[model samples]
Target: MRLDPPPTTPESEHRRRIGAVQEAMKREGFKLLIAYADCWRTANVRYFTDFRPVDGVHTIAQAVIALPAESDPTLFTGDGCLDYAASETAFDVAELEHLPLYLRRHLNADGRVALAGEEQIPVGLHRTIAEAIAPAPLVASNLLAKIKAVKSPWELEQLRHAAVLTDLGMEAVQQAVSTAGQVTERQLARAADVAMINAGADTPAYLSMVQAGPRSAFSLALPTNRVLERGDLVLTDIGARYGNYVADGGRGFVYGPPSGQAREIIDAAADAVEAGLAAARPGISAADLNGAIQAVLIERGYAEFSGEARGRGTGHGTGMDPEEELPWIGPTDHTVIEQGSVFTLKATINHPQVGGLRTERIVHLGATGLELLDTFPMRNFW
Candidate 1:
């Protein structure tokens, strides 16, 4: 089910992640874990063994994790799936049913068994794991989140790759504006997509937001077939994923020139992003962070925020999954901002007539300085 990976590539990161798992197992007395996902987002599966499941599907590259208290971990996945991935990365993979009997035999003889990440845990599979590793604590420590929130050096490098791709994607939009006579919003998005994919990225990161004209003035917009005019404002937010980790980047653009409400909202949104970033130190609370930017947003002559959600929670947890775990850029986060937490602050301002202004920045809470995941811009692209 598994094969030794090449000397470079994925193996080194896999080994480092697994070594962390072994230490956690010893400290916590966790015997084994069963991590299953279509995506390689499951840190346990990736850490315990180098078996990234078929991304975006559950049955493809799935894994059944087995680890004794202090032993090198093992993984059971689809035949040839692990081997194929291992050719690119390093991991210890095997083929075995995740039945109760098989798990009991593979797990530690006598110790506690803990679930690594229960949020992503499947309902039916929880029963399977419970039946197999019974009589132990079966703890829900969210250990994976704790381990992954902090960035490793290699992960930081890969994040830069994702960011660089996003930068290239933004450039595509600029190119379209400079040369094109007329193009649909969807077409503009496609151009950016093509550029990002061709820029050493596995995919186009994600759909570049190309809401044009009046349609560009809101949150949660789906792309449509509206074409650009000589003086159309467009919002293009795009991102890329490297090694299953996401680095989201976005920007606002004007095919001609921005004025009136469009100009005000764009400036306000960029300032708000800056305010939020300024307040995101290790000791500051998420509430304080929101307050810093919320004050700026209110000062910019926009309507006051009036929702329980707390300012769109611009920052979210980042890792293999779409959301790593939590985004506490509001008052909800009681957890102290740790020294190494990776969070994406997507602060933006929106106006009814003008388009939305947004910026995506990945920040690592460091002792003295924060390492940016990407440094594109919140300015007008064209």
Candidate 2:
């Protein structure tokens, strides 16, 4: 399938992001390497050469950009490169490009090299690369993962754009909840999802969640066509992906007349999320944030959480390619909050007798403290 039109990445900024990885590899002992990436299928290689593949809605897995220790990086992709890569990508590459041939042409055989990507790399390609390199076991190390986990200035800006789009999508969801006689669970899901896509999000991150009334009672939530009615509560867990970055959040809304009890649960969840965000900073551990929030829920006497919510951390890092990363912003997590990390703050409290209430937002670690990246309000939709 033909992907979306390419995005023009600033040449210098692209180089700088990769340069950080190059420097880190030098510190370790690998003389050469490849930063492999597939935006599902279209290999949007972002590196010194400035190629970021923008695939419209394809599920990418094997695509990757290989960067040698000292060479201009190139993309290795399937036949789609002829259509998408040549016209849209920042740097064009050979189609159905064999990694070994590309390596022989680009990298020296005798030098020590480190491989990229997760353990899921195709075994056939893995064997081929192993045979060519000298008999050194290029252990599975996540050099690129570590380097890219921290967002660059340009990356953060893209994330900001994504957050804005997602916020608007949530607003649409609020409107849908307010005007409908009774929202079918699936339709509510589509409303928020369509809102994101219409607002320039490349796609909704996933089938956004819509759990209604008792349906919201489950920790593992799914969207169904159940008609919501009065005294029914609705919770939507939603996110939008743009420019390869994403913004995810959740909010609850009342369908019919509100009950005093339902309002209390929504307020509690929102306050818990706020309490957690307030605790997030450079010095605090992930567990600290989780503890702060859970303390509120536990005090309110709703200790039970959706899917063992206490076990769920507030959130983790997000950036190009890698979906989630370090600083699991919840209790018992030791990941330290650091400058440059962007995380989502979410708290969903589930009650089997009633329903569930949740509030989520995006937050970044600032030089001074935690800065809220999301603007969506915490209250259940009006």
Candidate 3:
């Protein structure tokens, strides 16, 4: 629980990541790569330069890392953040306005330009870059995402610490639910947030979810002032962030002694998670892992509440971002699981009459098999 000198990604690792992206660009015939980041979606730029921009009402925080095929990469940010970016990032820092000039200097007439964060980039800036590098054709690229799917040793360590903090938060929620008289959902969520921060978390990975009774039927809901009652099914989904890496998981709990239907729903979700964990390995496809989980839910007569029925995946990759797109654990994703890949293995079942139940675990695929990063028990009835 005590990390005197917190673990961090060294400067050398950032250099190595830049090299990997450059190699990918080479293969894709990209002459220049523009990686963009904002306060919200920061993985692309932060992965390469290690500079997380700060956003404010007066100051719009945005960053771009321009990596040309032939020269060293440059990090560009707002004038307000130039000094901070220079101090934090390993690459050369420049003002945001210079990005067009940098692109003009490095880009050739015939070569194509690849953009890593096309969706998040502002339309005006995108048009400017497109005009600046006219005839070069800006194309969306998933090079960074593909590379980030696999975790390095250092990233795995950070994730492990994140998982520990997340578990502590969940433990605090359980204790609050059991001991507090007439506790509200908001209070439980506050308890979790305080516990994670006190346990050395940078912050909660996302807003803590505390849904009780029929409110739990929704897949995602923010904590409200609804008070707990006896025999009410409570669903809590919480996570913690440490060193910019995050761990996500959820569990089902009861305010008091559980009902027979509540017990059945919780057990089915936990069983599905177990099946998914057993089927997870290096060689399997994401679809196969999801199938294992789905099979359990269907066998338990919860077919209507399966992930496919709900039009959502069972889980997704978790790292620099809480929900990554790669290594997507669902029926449609065909990406192969690789060693050192970390993702959430979750089973969520929502019955119209019985309410909703979910159980999730942060798992890492190693050379041997899947390793569960979370240590908390799956079932909770208080």
| TM-score winner | 3
lDDT of 2 by residue, 169-211 (tens): 8888778877886678898889888888877888876668888
Q: What C-alpha lDDT values do all the predictions have?
A: 0.64, 0.68, 0.84
Residues 120-226 of candidate 3 have per-residue lDDT tens digits of 88898899899999988999988877888889988899999999999999999988877887899899999999999988998888889988888888778898999
Between prediction 2 and prediction 3, which has the larger TM-score? 3
Error of 3 at 254 (Å): 1.4
Point out the worst 10-residue segment of candidate 2 by lDDT: 41-50
| Candidate of highest lDDT | 3
The reply for model 3, stretches above 4 Å from the true place, is 57-59, 306-311
Task: Give the lDDT ranking, best first.
Answer: 3, 2, 1
By TM-score, is 1 or 3 better? 3
Give model 3's TM-score versus the native structure: 0.95
**Clash pairs, model 3 backbone:** none
Q: What is the TM-score of each candidate against the true structure?
A: 0.83, 0.84, 0.95
Reference-based lDDT, residue 310, model 2: 50
Worst 10 residues of 1 by lDDT: 1-10
